[model samples]
Target: MMFGSRGKARFLAAVEGLESAVRDRDAKRCTRGLREIHRAYGKAGDQEIAEGGARLAALLPELPDGPRGGLAVFVGACVERGADARRCAPAVLAGLAQALEAAEEFCERWAASGGGDFPEPDDGDPGPGVVERGGHCAAFGWWTLPQWEMAAAAMLSHVEVRKELDSIVRARLLRDLRTVTEASGHDFKCLEQVLLVLDDEPLVALDRSSGAGYALRMTGLGDTFQLHTLLADVLIGGGHLPGQAPSAREAAVCRDAPGQVPTTGSFNLVAPDGSLLWNEGTPADIPVVDGVRLLVLDPPPYRRGWPAGRFFPNMPGDLVLERVLGAEETAQWFTQVAPAKG
Candidate 1:
């Protein structure tokens, strides 16, 4: 209620204003407004809002030169501002690792500015990217869209920025990452191997579990974690990222995840309460992700694109995880998963 009554109004209005400015091609006005929004974001105290604001600050540099050259300025400024290439610093990791591959392919469509850089590419036409920007989000930096959104949301929960800008930022990051990486590294992953995903995708909730949470592990990768550190390096032609992220032998591992993809798709995660877990690889014996209040997965079988399982309504379109996991296949794949036994 506090968010709605005080924060939501300004947040909604600012985003609407941004949309209008972008639509009208008012780059100057839009950039300025974004700057103000960033400052105001810090004042509000929401984790997402503050995090997104700093990212927006990174994006602002690209603006003065117009959208065409704005991104370069943004990246240049980010390097100067000290974005952490060695770690997944919330303020610095703009979802680059997840989107580096497609972003490079996508940036090829454009030509750069006075520096002879390739120009900016169109918002669409991403290459081999899994978390393509959607109509709902845009990015202000190079990390994953979901992480940025989560960061922004964290800030907003405290400060309240605007309507969830996850989709808006997702789209923007994909666009910028492409531009930033173009001509930087032909073999994106060869440079680094962190599987960063800028996901605007939704969770296919299988169950609406009671008192569910999630198990989130934000591992700090090693210097060998090239994917996360260098993929973006090749795209933007800046932030060389030291050719390695700080990693211990235990921290050094390949960027392998169930969501390793470069297609124009969204990343779907199940709520830790066992609401949704990809019916792949995960051992049921492993505990559920913490604080998972919901699950996400394919739609029901009766409908098009429905999951390969039996489903019942927990909240109309929503269902409890166990109900959907009734699929023998799902149950089999997940060794550690089971409905919360009362």
Candidate 2:
């Protein structure tokens, strides 16, 4: 809930240290991370209010063998201060559990590939695991929008700050982030990468057990907020996320672009009765209509940004929704995801 130049630096530096510590299997570095994080809170104010700092210290030791769980837990705890904990706690706990499970899955995959035991990085130079240009950490960092939102939510959970969760605040935050990153003189791309690693994109779930089911694409800050809202609805409100929740234009694009894209941009989106559902830069997954591949792109060859161009050139409409939702649910879902240019 507190913000300043120095405090922000301490927070981020501590996060970087914690990430490195987890990767290197170093308990001492973990302790150092806690100290730094605590100092960050202190610099913001005293971590005395809500006993947040102490709670965080206690929770840090319970972090899994990976950085993801601890980072998420820390953000959740920090954000929960003075919040309606009874309302948000369940979702926070469930989200943390999901993060831990995801990290465990990644570790298992790494181990299965005959990857040997983990070892510490070199004394002076952290290995590719640390944020480096064109490194594994860089790639993971790039798409971590989900994690950033978790942190942002925590920062904004307080009553006064929560009021600023709109476009203006987003623009300010993005600008401030850019300024801070520039001041730090780190690689902007790498920083961007690190900030976005917490996302759960291309996947939607009714509950934790659904195991990455369904497809959802989130493009910007508004979508990120929408995602948090949807998750809160599911986890806290006991509601269900619809199987297909595309924008209105997106639905039309889906209907029009089945199996082929006649034009490059929005010029070709025409519905069955000659309604134009034209929109640009809307994204969708591979469209499977009636058990047939309706839209497909030639899977691009492996190279830098290989899959970026592999999307079928057109946006499909509500066929996926028709397959997945009842008429009532479909109507409700459309109302919920009504197209907005945020």
Candidate 3:
């Protein structure tokens, strides 16, 4: 529903009040402002909600720690409450993305300077530092960065946000997250969760022969063995395969021989142009197309694995497959034996 002029005015006023309350750290005022905003959202239309989102995004970089975090959560809640997040949340995502980049740079510089004087971050704070025994420590930003990262992750978890995000933006966010994780030497729970959400997002699986398409979600199956195992299930479920499942021994052949009998691994994934989808990185690194990734399942000798060495005839098997189907699957394959005749 579209908002009348008065409703729009009320939303603007509520946003302004919330920003002021956050800056003042006035809990009572903050609550009142939040209530007013919620009331406005209930009465306002999608365009007004999006406009309000833009206003909140403008204020995000200037908010203090508690208020910033709280506001991020509130935005996610608004999406959950059916606020047309596809329209309203992209600006919020962009704001968080920019803030995270700025925070990362600020922390890197602060750490390098060894507690020396540094300019305030884009957030307008004095940088994350605290006094201790009459000395300042620059290490505090490392701790503070996680809060912001998690807040961004929480917002991104929404389905609308994930669908609305541009592929380039999503990839950059993942790269930035990895950089921050490597630099900080800290494993963030949010990082893992977000990786699963983004990397394992459903892809369009196309059947070349029949031209049928399916939205396949390979959750927790980015690794080789798990991925193929799930792929086999998908094939069987989709009626692309017949009879009972094959043994692990035969299934292992899918990694190399694409079309040999007695193994469902003969199927290969290719691009829309029928080119091999080679990967030097994990599945998350796969290129996305048209806001979604596509995988064309073709008759085997699956060549999606790592490229072979040029000079050395037998340098090693495909590194991508070796990495995907690690020792764990090898061990499992060795343990299984043909069924004993009764």
Candidate 4:
């Protein structure tokens, strides 16, 4: 949509206000300025948003580490508030690259200082953790990590950001992410998400019925046993499948049995036309949909001695499985299909 003269005026004013707010380090003013930009972009198209993001990216390096992170998050929030992530990805990735570089420098400096607090930069504004007690005075401290994390999470969650990365940058980012994840005790969600993107993993759909299921990013799975374990975990965790407490022998029996074994019954991975795709095999052996395997776990037989009740609650009695492919497609599926049913 073409911006009218008034809308153009509003957008430019909002951008000017945001620049002023960032320069002054005024958090409230920054937020208000962003909200104004958001309002100005109410009917803007992707091109307009992308242009706005480019304008915002120009101001990123002027801010401190904390507010740099905040601005990155605000961009993500704008995406969530109906700004297109793909359109905003260039700016987001640019900011992420900067944050990662800063974090790397901080890590090197901290290590060089023998794990003690390092001298703050001469920017007058105290860096990260410079006050409050308990070893909180450093050039970069605990305060910076969460900000970096939030920024990373916001950028890495969208697939388009990965497309914006060149090979060298992607490798550097993966390395830096590993460093940060290690420092943060290996519990980083952004790291996990990025790995999925890097490995070109598919989105796994737990198909319940026609037009209903839960979709999760596919993680590494070695074999059918691991796949079965994952399915059981997800199903039992979500209260869709009953928790099983089979006897030692029974447990062994189930475990020892070949692919896709239920606690007391049987299941199959079947195609939409009822042909068996995988009655027994590893995930790698499953059929591919758009370059990634899509497995639809057929509902377990409902029989006596087996766990009773609807295998997939709220699903139609006649189950018809469907599959979606790619990060973008699966994400779209989640937003459009799964939210209402799931």
* Candidate 1 deviant stretches above 4 angstroms: 1-12, 45-191, 196-342
Scored against the true structure, residue 248 in model 3 reaches a CA lDDT of 46
Off by over 4 Å in 3: 1-16, 19-66, 113-144, 154-160, 189-232, 242-282, 285-342
Q: Is candidate 2 or candidate 4 better by TM-score?
A: 4
How big is the positional error of residue 340 in model 4, measured in Å on the Cα after superposition? Answer: 40
How does model 4 fare in lDDT?
A: 0.49
Give the per-residue lDDT of model 2 (tens digit) for 183-250.
33333342232223221123222121221122333322111222232332332233233232333332
Residue 94 lDDT (model 3): 62
The alpha-carbon lDDT assigned to residue 334 of candidate 4 equals 39
Models 1 onward score TM values of: 0.24, 0.24, 0.44, 0.45
RMSD of 1: 19.2
User: Model 3, 1-342: lDDT tens per residue?
Assistant: 244777877877898898898788787887788779878766665665666665665566555444554566556555444455555455556655655575456457646657343332243333334323112223233334554554455455455556567878877776766665566555654544454443345565554444445555543222333344446545653355553444544333333333323333435556555555532223453346666555665555433332211111111112111012234533343232122112
Clashing pairs in 4: none
> In order, how many clashes per candidate?
98, 16, 4, 0
* Per-residue alpha-carbon lDDT of candidate 1 for residues 35-118, written as tens digits (9 for 90 to 100): 555434323434334333344434432332223223323322332233322221333333333334333433332222212432
The C-alpha RMSD in Å for every predicted model, in order, reads 19.2, 18.9, 14.9, 14.8
Model 3: how far residue 21 lies from native, Å: 5.2
List ranges where model 4 is wrong by over 4 Å.
1-12, 20-54, 62-66, 114-145, 183-186, 198-342
Evaluated at residue 281, the lDDT of candidate 3 is 24
